[model samples]
Target: MRIEMTTLAEQPVAGVHICFFTDSLEPSGLGVHLLNLMRWLNPARYEMSLVCPDTPGGRWLMERAACVGAVVHPLTVRDRRDQASIDRLYHILTSERVTIFHSQVGISWEGMLGLRIAHRAGVPVRVVTEHLPYLLTHPGQVAEHRETTRLAHRIITVSEGARRTFLERGYPAAQFICIHNGVELPPERPLGEAARVRQELGVRPGAPLLLTVARMTWQKGHSTLLAAAHKVVARYPQACLAWVGDGPERPQLEAGARALGLAGHIRFLGQRDDVPALLGAADLFVLPSRFEGHPLAVLEALASGLPVVGTRVCGLEEAVADGETGLLVAPDRPDELAAAILELAGNSELRRRMGQAGREQVAARFTARAMARATMQLYESLLCEALGRTDGE
Candidate 1:
């Protein structure tokens, strides 16, 4: 049952080559987000291809990309600046007959090389998705984007904030399009397993379990969350917080937890594939990210029926509805963050209501199907302009 229907032969999306040039796909997040979108894109209407650099996690992407059943090509692009990698990418575009390139990464040298190859291949359209906030810390990214934006036809950003930044940074105002990250709904099954999942994870019954799945990075606001956790523990000692993913900040965050006397209450789960299970066990989902380009983990939490508490950052604004689906506090404010989290943690009825509301919101607006359809329509529009079938230009 498709919403917007177009026949396979009439719209025949065979020659479309979508290249995913990234450092890796397994450290997860954006790569997985792109994979989910590609997997959901209707094969009858679009053909997908991926191109990622050789990294520790590249093998995982190759494996997942294969399982998605698409024409997958692996290219070992050297870390951004290597000229040899650029040459190899050019060969791939020519040999594969790639006409459209879609990059879910930013303006790295590797990404630049891919775009160069696409331009050389006479690829009518090149679309780059901005997955990070570039206005503040990454001014180089904003500049690189401006330098490359002229070569590409359009820029696809996950948040209006990112788009606004690009416009502010001298990128062509007309070339940006905002496409929010979406989630695929969880399987329809009994939620009773949540109790078992929580038990195995060592979370006591009726004890507030605040869950956050993210890399321990500054952008994710781990520092603020850590500070807030101290406040939550001070008030509700039985309440616990879980960090599902690990990163460079893990040791520092662990130190903070210990210093704050939250040794027994906070658990670092590291990296795990059982996110759905974790979401099931969680009472409240929190993402105090300083900024985002639409967080996939938070979307999954909402899809899994968990109440949320997040900051008012780029992609987060589109995720948590203020005082409705969840709470939104000012970025970097641990006091405000702690208050919101504690409020939800203390109120079981509010948690359930918000979680239900979140589920309904995602079901209606953000879904894998909806994202795929919208992306495919853009692809068709670009292809039509190339084929001279419609006046897309």
Candidate 2:
């Protein structure tokens, strides 16, 4: 499946063929980012393709990619060591005549094998976007991630903080770039949609509805948020915390909530497609993540004109301007989180002001079009360099 490298002049004149690879099997922030690229990348200048898992969860992304005219290649691999999968990927890359192979990584080393296969297939330009900061725990993964860094022609980090983390880890500064994650500013929710959502959740009107949209994972700090919810509810009995999204930690979190006697105050809505309406109904948005790579939830919340209460960690810190767009408290501190949430809950005017500021900030700096344009520019620069051609050419 080795593809012999060809000069740009040797190929028939056509748009650049860019193929994206991801191992994600579920709808996630990564999927949203990919959709943004698909929607915004000019079809006149580039042809797009996606290689993703073929599972039911993956179909959510597959269907969306197709709607945007990107060719979808359903892929399955039992494990990283599955040579058959690797060969299959190589064949796809070679047969598709991919000009640019861009892989998205949730953590460091994710989709590394795809990059390796793309490299072996002699793809002219290879890119990998790290959606999170580097992990410092595992020595084996650290080594593998370094190999991934070498395989990529360029490595994209979703936040400046994430890029700095890689630079501090000795990755070549010249090879990495920081591109902040962005979201499409959703259109206004249908009239009465917010009320309908609140009614469905059994939240009474005038009750403070604190909303959190994130997977029920340890890294998301759901436990810390649950603790904060306990404190917030004790003070304002009418306040309700609606938890959206689900993951492996859900059962444990539900059990903890029951144990804390928070059954009446906390509602687990699980995964729903009506997040925009939920955001519209919520009084404030809270994300108590221990770490992140520019969470889309916070951005969406801000876009929905809701002030955020997040942790003062790397990715969250960058998205939320403390005391302006939202309040950022120290991570893992339930008391601080509770205090901040209560502070916003008590002041409607302050919440409105901050929410307006957040919306303005997003419109000015973090739009899906901005992210896509930056990414496409990077792709073009790298492709031109690989072909020994200038941008003007």
Q: Number of the top candidate by TM-score?
A: 2
TM-score of 2: 0.96
Task: Report the CA-based lDDT of candidate 2 relative to the real structure.
Answer: 0.87
lDDT of 2 by residue, 1-393 (tens): 333544432454357899899986664888988898789998899998999999876788899999999999899642667777877887788778888999988877578778877877878889999899987678887887787669789999999999999999899999999999888888888999888988888888888999999988888998998888877888888888999989999999889899999988889899898888899999999999999999999999999999999998988988999999999999899999999999999999999999999999999888889999999999988877787788577
Instruction: Look at candidate 2 and give me any clashing residue pairs.
Output: none
Quote the lDDT for 379 in model 2. Answer: 90
Model 1 RMSD vs true structure: 6.0
The lDDT of each candidate is 0.75, 0.87
Model 2 alpha-carbon miss at residue 200, Å: 1.5
Question: In model 1, which runs have C-alpha deviations exceeding 4 angstroms?
Answer: 1-14, 24-27, 76-81, 106-110, 136-143, 189-191, 391-393
Each model's total of backbone clashes? 0, 0
TM-score of each: 0.90, 0.96
Q: What is the lDDT of residue 95 in candidate 1?
A: 59
Model 1: per-residue Cα lDDT over 117-205, one tens digit each: 56665666677777765544467754665576577777787767777866776667888787777888998546687888778778788
